[model samples]
Target: MPTLRDIMTPGLVTVDPQATLKEVATLMLEQDIGAVLVMDGEHPSGIITDRDIVVRAVAYGHDYGTAVTDYTTGSVFTMEADTDVQQAAREMADRQLRRLPVTEGGRVVGMVSLGDLAVRTGGSADETALQGVSQPSADPQ
Candidate 1:
């Protein structure tokens, strides 16, 4: 029964919403992370993941110089630090999201990925949740 605080990648990586997709990609690479928060002051305005860049931006021939927020999941869904791993997994799957930002005291604290869930849940995780998230979508953005 690991909590999100136990397994999440502690520490937040953020970018201004105005930053270009290219810049966001560069940051993710430099940090060795798959997601970054688009911060609007102290709150998150959106979230962008490596998959989002590839599926939503690259696949669509979106200009690299366009603002990252344009491709971000603008209505961000986050989990509190103490949330159970299984609960987090279910929510992510239901949302068809691969990553989620972790929060504490209404502030970004860490990040969780499906990979984290797999490892923490002893690799079995949840097949239905995994398939739900991994399914292909024709979403334009």
Candidate 2:
């Protein structure tokens, strides 16, 4: 069983909380990622997913220039880099989350997603957790 530090994406894709939704969306698309950390300097303040843009900003008729903070998930869940991958998977399953920031000494170091877990440790449990995360959500964001 790998630690999160072994399998997590080893860098953060971040956006300033004050950035426009358009800017963040472009970055996500260019990076081919599903989520971006909303950073306040080196501190992570929130997260913004593609679902957040479509559900919160688009559905609400907010324009592209809208601040990312207006629709970003304000409270993010994180895991320590040393955490066991299975335990991290359980936390994500319980929260119905697809991504978690990986931290070291309380500083953001990387991110882990359902795909990362599944690919690094292929097993029934990881498969199930990934399926659960991939399921459509009514709340979207």
TM-scores, all candidates, are 0.85, 0.89
* Model 1 lDDT tens row, 1-141: 788898888878899889999999999899998888999998999988899999999998989999998888888999899998878878888788888889999999998887887776676555545987987765834
Candidate 2 residue-wise lDDT, 68-141, digit = tens = 99888877889899998888888887778888899999999999887787677876347656766767776853
Best by TM-score: 2
Q: Please give the CA lDDT of all the candidate structures.
A: 0.85, 0.85
Q: What is the lDDT of candidate 2?
A: 0.85
lDDT (Cα) of model 1: 0.85
Clash count, predicted structure 1: 0
Give stretches of model 2 more than 4 Å off: 131-141
Give me candidate 2's TM-score against the actual structure.
0.89
Clash pairs, candidate 1, are: none
